[model samples]
Every structure is written in structure tokens, then in C-alpha cells.
Target: MADIEDEDEFDDLLELLMTNWRNVRQRKMPTSSGADNTAMVASTASTRKNGGAKDDRQLAEDAKVEFDMSSGDSENLPDEDEMEKKVPIPGGVDIDLNEQAAPTIRLNPKAKKVGAPRKSKTVTQAGDKSDRKWYQQAEQGRQQAGEVTLRALADALAREMPSLVDTQCRLSGVIVKFSSAESKKPKLRMLKNPVVTMDPFYLLPPKLLDACMKVLSVANTSECAIEVDGSQETRTVAKKDQVETVVIKDVGNYSRKQIENFVRIQNLKTVVQLGLELHKWLTIEGIPALPAKYHDVANQVAAQVLETYPYTQIDCLPALPDFTFSMLYRAIPPTWLSDASIRALCVRLTHDFPSCRFAGFQDAVPHKTRTRRSSAAPVSREIQDRVFQQVAEEGVECVLLPLNFHNTHWCCLVVVVSTQRIFYYDPLNQAVHLKAANAIAQHLKISGLQAYDVAAQNNPIQFDAFSCGIYVCWMFIRHVVRGPPLDMSANALPRRRFELFFYLLSGRLLTREEAEQHEAEAAEEDEKMPAPPAASNADEEEDVPLTQVAK
Candidate 1:
């Protein structure tokens, strides 16, 4: 009995082990395919949320497997109640019971929350960044396209009309419709369709248009027109004519009249004063008088007294006033006269005129002779000295001596008369001293005395004597009269001389330096003085009294 019991226990133990093995295997296998059905339901829910159709649901149902289980026809026995108990649910649906549980699939706890996406957010952050970059690139491309369109329009205008190369045409008044069907491109319309339309082709040159555009860009506005009247060419021609005819009619005529009027006016008193002044110089400076033979004529002519007497007696013959004849005796070559005449005149006059001496020639000295005769008249040095000494002894401040010549049928004889010493010549004495020809020749530094054609010859001796006499006269006038020197030249006087003359004429003598200083002082005084009150007309009534004017 014990052996049988032990065997039965072993059998029982084997049965329990088999039951446990069956249970374990069942748990490892799929259950009733219901889990797949649950998976279909979950898939259907996902599809419905994603806007899928019922056809997809039907397809899911068609893919499902159907199985039936009867309680009476069962081949296997059911499990105990404790073994059939359900397990705790997980976060995700179970696909394989044998497989390890997925780490709490989580079901995206934050899904469909406030900021979460309603759909599956399977795209990566890098993909989203890429998408944004692409969108920005597209926007940039659109902007670039707009710029390219404008640039193309501008380029088309530039190519069609070269005159509009750098210039922009703005639509004034109204915008015009440019039909692409009509002309394949855009065009500028400065005016409406009318009888006359300016063709851009013939309007302006390409180079000029470029220049115009540059000017317009600087000015920032179109305020000027493209002058097509050929005015530029006309202006150029007009300018050429203006340059050629520079002198105006009135200006030319006035200049000529001014020159003529200047030459016509002469001062006679200045000439007489000049001669008297020369006589005074000769007397004060100890220059000798003229030679005895020619003394009377020299004095008479130079004193301007030749017109006083018609016929003057010289050595028992009658002598007439002859300027032409007198000039002949003084002829000398231009060059010889400049050097020799100055020296001879100064030497002779130093004796002839008691006070005057010959100053050097100021104007250009001539060098050409006009006479055939080389010999010239001379004056003696001894005679001139004796004459000067006599005048000095007479206590005469100044003396003019005259020399006269009488050409008779027999011979030519001369007489000397001193105007200053005319009172000294007594009619009772009745005796006249004469200068020898040799002495005269020696004093004059010439070989012989000969006649000269005054009209033909540039007589330097006479010219020198005239200039020296003028200079001496000017010096004497300046020194004795203490006044300005007179100008006898035909040309206009120097500015300084004119100013001096005007000052003397005005009876207000002031040097230029003094005048400037006085002007400055006067200006200062004017500034210091109070301004004068404004004068009112009687017709214009005054609103205030004179005492209340300042207030």
C-alpha cells in the first residue's frame, strides 16, 4: 500500500508539472487575435484623426481574422479563474506577449496640449530650419526678380534711344498705357497722341544726351528743354561777329575828337612868361650876354619884341624881323649839335647871359644834317665875358641883348644893342664896339659862318638853345616866383604837374603827402562829428517838433 501510494503521488506531481508547463506556454503565445483587433481599432482611430475615409476602415476589417469558440465542443480544458485574471495595462498596446515591454511608450503626454502639434511631429528641427531658409531664399529671389524687371526696362529704354542713355523720362500730366501687343516693349510719351510727335531718333546726339543726363542728375529735376532750334550754332556765329567788331561807333568817334581838341588849345602867356623867366635866369646866374654883332637881334627876338619895330637900324642899314633867316645861322648836324652844340652853347651863354647856364638836352638828339654847308656861325668867349661883366657892374638883375643885321647892296653889317644897358648907350658917345669874325668863330667852335636852310635842316644848335632856354626859364620861374613850372610842350602835362597846377589854381597849395595826411585827419573829424538831422519838405507835414526830434 505504501509503494502504491508513493507511485500515485509521483503521478500526481507529474500531472501538476504538465499543467504548469501548459499555462506558461499559453501565456507566451498570442491570445484570441483580439490584441490585433485592438491594434486595428487604434489604427482606425489614428486614420480618422488624420481625415482618412471609411474605405480604409473597411480595408482594416477585411484584413482582420475571424475565429469562433464553443464551450461544449472544446478540445482543451479552460484555465483556473486565478490564472485567467487580467494584468495591469501598459502605456502602449501590446503587439507580442513574448516581446519585452516597450519603455512606457509614453503616448506623447504633452501631445495636443496648448502649444503641441495636432498632427504627428515626425519632422526634425534641422528640417524645419532648412524649410525656413528655403522660404527666405524664395522671398529674396522674388525681390531680386522685381529689381531685374526694373533694370531690364531701363536697359531697354537705353538701347532703343541712345539719347536717353543716362537720363530718365518721367511721366508728366498723366500715366499713359503702353500696350505690349502694339510695340513689343515700353516707350516714353511726353505728350498725348497729336498731329506732331517728336521722334527721339532725330532729337539729340548720343554724346550730348549723355551730357544732358549727367546735368539732370546733378540738378535732380527736369526744368530745362532740349533746345532743338539750332540756337547754339547761331550763338556761336554771333559771338564770332562780336569778337571781330570790338570797337563801338561812339567810342571810336569820341576818341578821335578828344585827340583833336587837345591839340587845338595853346597857352600864349606861358610862352612869354617862359622867355622873361629865361632872361631873369641869365641875369642872376652870371651867364654872359650875346656877342656884340648878334646881340641886338638875339635880344630882340628872344625878348619877343621883334614885332614892336618894323625896321631897326643896324650899321646904317634897315633890318627886318626874320625868323627864317636867323635859324639859318644856327644850323648844325644832329649828332654834332647834341655833343658840340650843348658844350658850345653852355660856354657861350656862360659869358653871354649873366646868370643862366645851358642845361643838357632832355629829348632825343638828332644825328642827321640837312644843310650842304658844314660851317656855322660862332660867338666869341671874350666878348661874352665882357658883356656879362658889364651887365653885372650895371646892377641889373636881368638883361636882354639884341643884335641886328643889315644886308645892303654893298655888304652885310651887324649892330649890337643891350636892352638892359640901352640906358647906358649915350647918343653923344655915338661909337659901337663890334665882335670880330675870327673871335666869333673861335667861341662857336666852327670854321666859318654860312647860311642854312632852316626848313630843310634839323638845326641842333637852335634846338639846343630853345630847350636850354626853356629849362633855364623853368628853373628861374620855380626859384624866383616860388611857384610851379609851366609846361609848354604840346603833349598833355604829367599827372604830378597837373595836380600841382590845379592846387596852385585852387589857391590851396599842398604837397601830395600833405594832402593824404590832411584827408585822413578830415575823415577822422567827419567821423567824430554828429550826423545832421534829416530835412523835411513843407508839403510833407512833420509829426514832431525840432526839439523833440531826437526823442
Candidate 2:
């Protein structure tokens, strides 16, 4: 019972010490009676001694006497006046007013904080170089991607690492046991998510990435095979045999013929031969591109182009696929866009009424010039962004969207947004086209246009071959210029566009006699016009890619 009581007192003493430690900085010497103050002073001294022989009262007195003589503030000890009014702590404890061995620091309890410490030197310098004003203002030889910031290319490159063929551990200081799980290395290469940091060595500069992209984009776009080193860590990728997506190439520009126009007959032939493989690909969907159920076919086509070309910029769709589809649809053997033109026959037929208005190369990136953009851009950004803004506001009913699907086929969707009506023209009448068109209508909701009303054109049999796209384009032209009240003509393919252009300028459709005379005049003009640069027959019919058409 006596031991328990002693333990309780010791616990109380420990609690007192904890309280003193907590309130050390708040140091306030409270008013207390002299007797109580003296008793607390004795207890504090006694607590410090461990099994000492001398009584606490004697030790306390000695400590007080020594401090009173040593301390400079000894004169400020509690006076008689303070003793008479002083109050003791309710728990029978009091702080000693007598000077201590160590002088207490006089802190200003009410001082306000000045400010937080400045960020470290490393942190302050971490901003990207493109964030600088000068880089953004630079409008010189290089063109910026319409919306990508200066650092975007660099960021993409940093994110893209080459897939490894064999396992080689890069991390150090790991124990390995023959029977342990750690003994085996990873079989499948897992790409680490790139950390976004300002470390200089973390990524190649944007200029370098931009240069690389342009070359790679062209290679894949043209169906020309080339090596690429996607794994930034290594300089060369040994290509004995590897999966198609990540081939290692030297870090420099490669030289290949750049194709500018589909009229360049050789390029078209080569591209068509490669494009014919797309039908096979769709049935067995896998490779450089994997087509989805709907609108994503554009990307799949772009990828297929890259895989075939082996030298395309990463996002080659904007420049490569769209151009390829446009050219492919127009350049099939024995079929050309009415005298080799991209302009619609209907546009020539009527323009006072808003007909097919071609958007310029810079129309998509309007209010800016000198752009260095990727060819395979997002469909929403490249196609929809530029759709119908000019025509819609002008209240023109018909809109022509030359949708380059899978970068292999071109399908026309005529939108009457105000009327919430959409008419799709695909001469092949493929169910896939219908599904894709519906997906497109949903996406059109962003433009404040909902294609609730949908219909498909019935005429112009596309046949089994690749003439469907061509037929689709003609249907739009025919529908806008002369249609709705149906008269199913047996044959509608006009041999010459020169007559059509003149007839359109006249603001009226040509009669059967007038059309024949116009055809004669158009043929004479063709004979007078200089022939395309002399090339062999083989070159004119060579399987060409989109590189020629995009330019």
C-alpha cells in the first residue's frame, strides 16, 4: 500500500515535468505564496537527485544560495510586496523566482512571422525552355503544330521509349538467388510512364523530336521500311527479327522522294496497291493500326500507312492519310475527278448558292501562319474544328465533309445542321460506313449540330472494286447541282470538267447539246495544255502512297 502511494506521487511528478517542458517557451512566472514557492523549489531539486543522502530542503537552499550569488538578475528576486499578493498553483506547485544557473532567453512572445523561405535554386530554374517568351514568338523556317505547344514534341518523344527485345536489368544493388522470384527477369517489356520533369537529360529537345517526327512520319506514310530507336536509352536497335512497331534507326534525317500530287501517276499506283491490303486488314484487325467499331478508323488507316511506309512522323494522319484518301479516291485507273481536279463539278455548277467550299491548308489553323504541324492530327481538331463554321453562319444548307476513313477510303457526309439533317454518300453502301457515319453524327454535337435526320443515297453503284469513294464524291456534286426530284440516269460519269466549270460560271446547267459542245472545247483545252512531266507507263501506274497527294 505504501509503495503504491509512492508510485502515484512519482507519476504526478513526471506529469509536472511534462507540463513544464510543454510550456517552456511560454514562460510566465505566476504569483504564489513564499512558503509554496520554497516547497516547490525543494521538490524540483530533490527530483534531480537519484538516491542522494542529503534532504531536498537542504539541497534547494544550497542551489538558491549559489544562484543568488552567481546570477546578475539576483536583485530582481520576488520582493516582500510580491510575496504578500502571490498565488500558488492549485496542484501545490510553484516556479522559483530565484535566479537559475542558466540565463533564460528573453523571447518576444508577440512577434509576427516575417515571410516563408524562398524556393530552392533547383526549383526556381525548372521551367521548360518553351515557356520562355522568345521561343513562342519564333516564327521562322520551322512551322509549329497548329495547337501543340513548343514542348509538346519533346514531351511525346520523352513518353515514347523503344520496346526491348531482351531483358537487361538497369537497376543496381539487388540480391539474386537461384530459387528466388527475383532470379527471373521480365519477359514482357513494360514501358514506364514518363515522369514530367525539367531535368535536361530527361528528354531530347523539341526541335530534335520535331525533326525526327517529320522523317518517321514520311517513312511510315510512304510505306517505306526504315529502322527507328524508340528506346531513348540505346543508340541502335539490332533488327535480326522484331515486332513491327519499334524498329531502331540512326538519329538523323533520312532521304526519300517526297510525293506532292496524285496526278503524279506513279505515286498513286503504289499507294493503291498498298491500300488494297486494307480490306484484308479490316477482316483480321491487328497490326500497326487496330480499327475500332466507329469514327476511329482514321487513326487505324494512318497507322497502316505508317507500317507500310516505315518512315512516317508519329501523327501522320493530318498530312499523310487524308491526302492519300483524297488522291486514291480521285486517281483510280480510267476514273479521275472530272478533268483531274480536286474541286467538285457541283461547285462549278452553283456557288451563288453555297456549294462545296474547299477549306485552305491554313483554314484549320486560321488567325495564324507559318505552322509546323503533324499530318496525323486528332480528327476532332483537324476535321470537325474546320467544318461548317464559315458555311453554317452564312446559313448554307449543304456541307461536304470528305471524311478520310482508315486513311484508305474517302466518304462524303452532307450535313444540313440547321435542319438537323445529314445525308451520307457511300456508293459501296457498306454497313460499316453507316455505323461510322452515326458515330460522326454524335461527335458533331460539339459543333451545335446534331444529325438526328439521316439518309443514304441509292444510285451510282460502287461495284466490287475501289470506285466507291469516287462515286460518293460525284453523288454529292450531282445532288446539290441537280437532284431531289429523281430522274435515274443510266450513266452520269462526265468525261471532262472544263465544260462543267464554264456551265457553272454561267449560273445554269448545260443542256445535252451544250454539254457535248463543252466537252469538245474542254478536250481542245487539254490538248493545248502542256502534258505532265514525261514519265514511263510503269511510274504512272505504280502503287503510290499519300506523300504525293498531301503536299
Candidate 3:
């Protein structure tokens, strides 16, 4: 009976041990904390005092049992008889049940259950305790794992002292070792977690640590077979064998080569801005006088262009004749308009509406021309010749010329040669330049047309300071089409800017319906896209990790 009782108690302990092992295997080790570091240090010190040989022996025994259980090789596991011989008796007590008188076992008063049924715990209370226990056990297991890994590394390094070859050890999918040779090369290697810091190095003698580093430096870089002990199995890993990672390069929110036209339009503003900046830099030695407040705006614009633009070259888009990037930049809002861009728009307008004749910046002279000291000496014959040269050839009924007043404001002048009427359009709603209107009238008369009369007409009022050129460009279209009153509201500015830019690029104006439709599509796509970080140079490639690159 005594022998049977002892065997039963041992079986219960064995059952508890097996149950603990299963729980440990199912859960992952927790991250190390301050308490974990203290626990790890204490464990490492205790391990070192006990010597490496003892730990190795214990590890070997544990590994043998664990391997047998994992591989379902029960035959290799110790039998009950062998286990009974090896394991000590529980509580260090021996019983004599055969003597017919059982010895009285003294129980500690402090440990006795003297309360009323130990007060049954509620379900929530029990669950809370279970969760706390789980966390505590996980923390303890992590410290133990870290301690064991450091011990293993030290022992391996010591054993291979003066001739350290490639060594690797993994615990629960954690890589705890890396070769010095592998680390020196420019290869993307796996990073070790719960890293053993230089604190452990101080534990070793100075001479020994120095010798270890020297040995590692002189270590051979040749490929060698190494054993890696994982949670489930121990396998041989070679240096030459590598797991490949694939990275897919994409542009904007969409995939490569599938970028939408609206997405490209969204980035065109920045491309034009940068190209203008580059051109300015080429001409001037220093930056332009645009306020420093726009510095961040320019930087952010460049970043968006780099991160989301799908093409490598800007030349992919249709080019405008006599329209440089600087001129394109001026077509956008808040930037001063350029005469070249206005001329380009006029050319396109003439192509679409052949009944009208348009004048270049030079054709209708905004500045006073040189005149001889005689009445019949052609007061502005040179200007008259240039302005009507095209109109006479085309036999057009109407002529429009965009005039720049003192190089600060943009206004338009229209002449109905057949009706003998002239209309002046000013973006600011201010009175038109009388001198400019009279100059065009004289040119028309010199070209053998009837003298024109000035007609009073109200034009759109300019709200912003720098958008006069945009308003002037729009006024020409409205007057030609005789469309509804122009929308010069704040909300319409951005829409007009985008439309004007699109027109300049495509050589055809987008109707109101088409522009609004594209804007809606762009808005939807914008909401779907995740915000990308500011990338200074999109051409610069990033070194993505193997795990993410694979995904």
C-alpha cells in the first residue's frame, strides 16, 4: 500500500507536469519588461554559478523527452520503472502503511483551511485570477527562455573559441545568433529580438571577451552546415540556402501602369510647379521672391508628385506649342499669368472658332509705338499692319486682343469691325485703358475698316489679386460663346484652374459636364486612397524587409 501510494502521488505530479508543458506550448512568450530583465539577470547568474555542464546535461534530458513526445516515439521515452528510479519521492517522506498504525502527519497551522468553505469565488473573479495567472506564467517563461538562449550562445561561442564558425540557435521562432561575417556584408539579415545586450559582456573577463571578438573577426566566410534548434524540431541549415522575397513596385493609389487619368491630373500641378522652379534656377542664381510662407507648400507638393505620379518622365503628356513649363505654371491660380500662355490659348481658340481673329501680345501693341513728326506719317501704321495682317487674310468679322496694363493687370479688347463697335473687358471691373482702345480703333481704320465706336459693357469683377489673367482668359470665351454670366466665385477658381490646365495640355476645352464628372471621380478616388508620407525623391528606392516584401 505504501509503494502504491507513492506511485500514485508521482503519477499526479507527472500529469501536472505534462499539463503545464501543453499550456506553455500553446501560448507565445511575452515581451520582456523591467521585471523580466531583473529575472533574466538573476537566472543567468544562477546558471553560470551552476556551470555550463550541468545546464547542458539538464537540457539534453529535457530535449530527449520533448523530442520523443513530439515525434510520437514513445518507445524512446523512459519507462515507468526507470522514471521511478530517477525521480525523487514527493515531499521527501516515506510511509509505513503495512504496520497497521498510520503515523500522524502534522499540518502547518498557517496553511490549514480554517475558514467556512473558503468562500466560493464568482465566475468573474475566477476569470480575472485565471487571466492574471496566464500573464504571470507567460512572463516567467519569457525570462527563462531568454536566460537559456544567452547561456547557449555563451557556451557555443566558448566551445568554438579561437575558431568560431557560423553558429545559429532559434527558440520559439526567435533567431538568437548571427555570424559576424554575415553581419558585415550589405545583406538584409533577420533582426534578433529580446537582444542580449553588452551587459552580458561585462560578466565575462576582459581578456576572454577580447579573444572572442578577435576570433569572430578572423572567422571564415565560407559556407558551412549549421544546426538550428526550433520549437518543434532541430534541422540543419546551410548558409547558401536562402528564402526569396518579391516586391511589387506601384505608382499612386492604383497598381503599376493602371493609373487613372484623373490621378495623373491631380499630380500635374506639382510637376508644372517643379519644372517652373527648375527653369527659374537655371536663369537666376538664387530663389525667387515668392513668400517663404509657401515653402512648406512647395515641399509638400513635390512630395505628393514623387510618391503618387505613375510616370518617370513628364514628356509623356501632350506638349503645347510655344508653351514652356514656366508658362504652364502661370496658368494655375495664385501665380502671375504669362503672355506666352495667353497666346497659346488664343491660338487654340482660333482653331476651334474660325470666324474670329486673335491678336498676339505684339500684334496689338500695348505700349505706345514710335511715330514720325508728320500727321500722314502713319501714326501707328506698323501696329496696324501686324494686327490686320491675319484678319484680312482670314476675312474674320471679330478681333480680340488680351492687353497687359503696365505689366500688372490683364484686360481684353474686342472689335466688331463690321458693326463698327468696340467693347473693353476689364477683370477688375475698372474702366478700360482709353489709350489701348483708341490704339486698336486707329489700327482698324488704318487697315481700311470703318472707325469703331466704344460700347459700354459690364465685365466680371475680380475677387483675388493674382487671378486677373485667369479671369481675362475666361472673359474672352464667355464673350465669344455669349454664355451665361461668368462664375468668378471662390469655389469656381480651383475648377477653372484645373480646366484651363487640361485645355492647355489637351488642346481642347473640357465642357462643364465633363469637368464636373472627372472632379467627382477624382474625389471618390481621393477618399479611397491611404495618405502617403512625404517622399523627397521618388526615384530613391527603399530597402524593404524580407517579410513585407514577400507580402
Per-residue lDDT of model 2, residues 1-551, tens digit only: 33556887888667666555544644745324567657666765555443344543454445556544443433534455666575533333444544343654433323466898677777656644434532344322023312133234223322442111100111011111112222222121122332222211112233333332343333355466655678756556565432112111332111212111101222323344434443243333322221133225434443444333211222222343333232322332334332223343333433545644543211111112334554442246655666657456664556666555554455666765456676666566666665556456545554556545676665655654545445654555564654333222323322212123223223334334445666899999999998789657865677767665565
Q: Work out the TM-score per prediction.
A: 0.14, 0.29, 0.34
Task: Report the candidate with higher lDDT, 2 versus 3.
Answer: 3
lDDT of 1 by residue, 1-551 (tens): 33556887888667556645654755533233557646755764666556565543343233332223333433333334533473533434434333334443213222356774455455666668866864565445434323222233333433442221111121111111112222222222222222221111111222322332332222223555555575545543332211111111121111221212212111111222332343343333212322244344334433432222111212211132222111212221111112222233233333534554322322111113343533433333444554445344543343322221121000011111222211111111111212222223233222221221111111111122123322222222232222333443423112222222222212222333344666799999999999899987889866885575565
TM-score attained by model 1 = 0.14
What TM-score does candidate 2 get on C-alpha atoms? 0.29
Residue 425 error for model 3, in Å? Answer: 1.9
What number of clashing residue pairs does each candidate have, in the order they appear?
Answer: 22, 50, 0
- Between the candidate structures 1 and 3, which one is better when assessed by lDDT? 3
Clashing pairs in 3: none
Number of the top candidate by lDDT?
Answer: 3
The residue-by-residue lDDT of candidate 3 on 1-551, one tens digit each, is 33556887888767556545643654423323547545644654555555633443365456656444333444544565776567432322333211234344432222447567644578768978966864565445445434333344334333442110111111222221122222231212233221212212112222322333333323233455454456667667666533221111120011111111212222332343454453343223211222254345344433433332222222323354335443554554456877866776676677767867786553323434554333342224554565667556645767777766667887777766567677766666653354555555554665565565676445567788899888877877765544346466776665466456546645646554445666799999999999989857888888887775565
Worst 10 residues of 3 by lDDT: 251-260
Whole-model lDDT values for every prediction? 0.30, 0.41, 0.49
Q: Candidate 2, 159: how far from true, in Å?
A: 47
